[model samples]
Target: MGESLQSIVNLVDPYTLQILVNIGIAIVLALGLNVITGITGQLSLGHAAFMSIGAFTSAVITLRTGLPFSANLLLSGLITAFVGAAIGYPILRLTGDYLAICTLGFAEIVKVVFLNLDITNKALGLSVPPARSPIPMPIIVWVVAILSIIFVCFMKESRFGRALKAIRDDEIAAEAMGINIARYKVQSFAVGSFLAGVGGCLYAHFLSYINPSDFGFLKSVDILSMVVLGGLGSIAGTVFGASILAAAPEFLRFMSQYRMLVYGGLLVFLMVFRPNGLLGGINFTDLVLRAIGRKPATAEVNERHRK
Candidate 1:
């Protein structure tokens, strides 16, 4: 199976392969943001900050410790999760646009800090070690992306997931139901940041470079758009959204001068026409089940009972 997969990958052009890897990274970022903004109803615009943390941490570890890429990736994610928890604990008390502002500020702060840090090589950036195999990095990215999607799907159905949904629907009601709002919110933030960090690690290795400019507020906005465009709480929707957005720039390369304008216009159109996002609350699994003449488990039960 591995040999066959490698053979297929080899048949693809390098440019296409690069785009696929980018889509994989975008998927991870979109899903990570989905956990906090989509599921937990938290508004964070500092996701790229976490990604920078992971990318820099992984790059340093690769250069200094000579550790394996897997180890570096894990450490980067752990560190970013810790940072997310620390940040979320205090700022999560704020809600709505205020929370969004704070997170955006946090992203700017992270960018500035990295810009001045000598260890991060300052604005010049650091080059990462090249991958051992020609196709290894993309494969690793795809594997991580798949695992992240599966994990998030399962999480969306778990007890904690329900609590998050409840919180998203009605914070007061969720609290009344004995859900630890603060605890769950922090957990979601941490988990989401962890996934972003993992994506960052992949990105650093793929490009063989790291810089704060690469993870600025614009990057965060791009990731957020993917989650929103895909359908906030839907994993499959996020994947679809990420793929489309990731490929959009390449497809619009011919209109280089108007690319961003077109992209922004498209987003505005989507927001106006499909405010709930492309998939919204619809689950792909439920659709498949219905197509197969079967009811989804949740659909079979009374709404109150399911809740």
Candidate 2:
């Protein structure tokens, strides 16, 4: 009993706190990815590129302008959103594997650009000052993540979200119904990129160091893994997926050389058993309403957004 109590006390340790921060950041990333890949049915493998842009943008802002953390976060997100809007307009024209390949190529281009840029310090990376935060890092991270999740939940039920879903479900049908496919797709990409930028900003500030390699192909894959592991369209699922994947490496530390093998095997096993994800098409919003003894609308409850 005493050991159990002692164990709980260790949850606030620096290492644990850092882990918490990582999980929160991952949740934020996954939330953004869901907007594109999950809801809009776009396959992107360059999410980390957007993240890197935000990281560098935030670092530069902090180092040069002396802005506070919140301002930097907002500015970075807006900048990334603009980039996404401009790039997504043309890139989102592709679909399926073609879209994935283009986005992946775009990621490599971003990485190369960052690696050559003098302001980013080239290959050596950038050392950033910590955010001028009013509260603890974990609190700030989780607060942003939680607010992002809530906003997504509300967004999911909004007309914009429904249009994205319609596009995802049947793009031709949606176009025939008068929905502007190109516009909605670009909007989704921009919004998702904004969230990814915010996540990257938080990550850079939390670690006080970042580099181009940090947001490479593998990092994009990792974020996608979280969204996949959780139900793709489910916000609650992103939380679960991010938490589990973020803590997985630490928990597997004892395995050393074999940890990655085990991790790969675990993901394979989960996918084989649950192809649609752990909670695919299961809306937590409906679950919440039911939990509180107020049944959600029949259409809402019956909605299945996952493909």
Candidate 3:
């Protein structure tokens, strides 16, 4: 058993570890954003604002004060959550295109602030201190992954989560049911932004460097695309979508100059065909249950049968 374990350990290296770590970070970010935009029906084109906030907060705390990584990450999420909630109060009332523009402007404002901020060294990237040695990157990745899974599980079960679901189903009906729609909307955005911020902190530590430009409009759009392409309310779909979108460019590098063009074309086709995404709203858990021959609740099954 010892020899087998040693062999298994040898099979995984730092490069593989890094890839795993990045995937965890991506899942955390994509799923969090999906909760708000997909389930709650909010449009936030400024998620990168939360990301930048988290990155800068962790960087500053770790560099200037020598705080532990765990503390910095937690605090980063908290700070970003507060910011998200505060911003959501006024902006969530806007609908559709207006909301998108407002969030877009919020992101630009954040970028501009970071650009001129002296404490962050402006455009110069912050250098992260190395993590305590002996603990491999894969272990950290696993920890982050477990945390993300737990966060999603809890959110799915929580009352606030149910409120978001209600809002998604029908805002008018949810309001009629006495659910405070605005409160839930803001809470969803805050939680989503908090997770995105935490993901950013982890990403910064993984990359060991970050700049204002790194968290630009494209980053926000990329994350938003992951949420949309993954399906509005499906956690597993979001993960799959994020992984494919993030890795496709690199995987197709062999295609040379035309790689991007082909990749873009493929995306268009995917959207056209699988408009709801791979597992939109139906996560791996649901698939597992189905594979075990479980069916939807009796009422739902009966309703479908009647239809």
Candidate 4:
């Protein structure tokens, strides 16, 4: 099945395939940010920094070591998670706009450090190894995207997810319910950063080159926008949002220099009209259950109590 899928992908035009690959990467980044800002209700503006960390780490590993590409990606995520945990420990205490400012500052610091680092090849950037197979990159990228979605969905259904929602709803109330806000907040940050790192690895390998400029504050905002537009805590919505945003530039080529203005306008429209996002609080499972003529668990419980 995998071979057949790859063969079909190989038949696609290079431009279209590239767009699909980009969409996959965007989905990964958006999903990661969704975990932090959506599910966990923490505002972050330094996600691109974690991506840079993963990209640089994986690129350096590929250049210096004989390790396989998968190993490089995994190690990059682990290292970035460690860095996120270290940063989150103290910074997570700050909420709302303060946390956003600190995260933005963190991204700048990472960018500057990368700009000066010789190992990262400075502004020149580092060349990543090409994909070994004709369809290796797209396959790898989509695989990671699928895994990220599944991981986040599973987490959303778990006790941990409930705790996250509790904290998101009311930190004080969550604490009263015995949910450890501090530990959960740090964990959410670390996990979100880890996913961002993995996305970075995929991006670096797909492009075969990366630099600090590629993962700037603008990139972080782009990712955050996807999460916001898709609906916080909605994995399926994130994927949809990523697909639209990633492909919008291609479709808006006629606008040329004005495309950004159009993009900004769209965001403003969404914020004003659909502040909760396109699918805010709606899950795919709920849709499935409704389609099957069954109420979701919560709906069923409500009906039962009413009866």
Worst 10 residues of 1 by lDDT: 130-139
Q: Ten residues in a row with the worst lDDT in model 4?
A: 130-139
Error of 2 at 222 (Å): 0.4
Backbone clashes in model 4, listed as residue pairs: none
Clash number for each model: 0, 0, 1, 0
Looking at candidate 3, what is the lDDT of residue 73?
A: 76
The C-alpha RMSD in Å for every predicted model, in order, reads 2.6, 5.1, 3.6, 2.0
lDDT of 2 by residue, 1-307 (tens): 5355435545688788778889999999999999999888999999999999999999999999977788899999999999999999998999999999999999999999999999999999999997876555667788899999888989988999999999999999999999999999999999999999999999998899999989899899888888888877888787788899888888878886785577577679877998778878788678778899887875554675431
| lDDT per residue as tens, model 3, 112-148 | 8988998888988788765433444445655776777
**Positional deviation of 92 in candidate 4, in angstroms?**
0.7
Tens digits of per-residue lDDT for model 4, 1-307: 6578768777989999999999999998898888889989999999999999998988888888888777777899999999999999999999999999999999999999999999998998888987444346788899899888888888988999889989999999999999989999999999999999999989999999898898898889888888888888898789989998889889988886886677678789988998888888788667767999988888888989999
**Least lDDT summed over 10 consecutive residues: which range in candidate 2?**
1-10
- Model 2 segments more than 4 A misplaced: 1-11, 256-260, 299-307
Candidate closest to the true structure, highest TM-score: 4
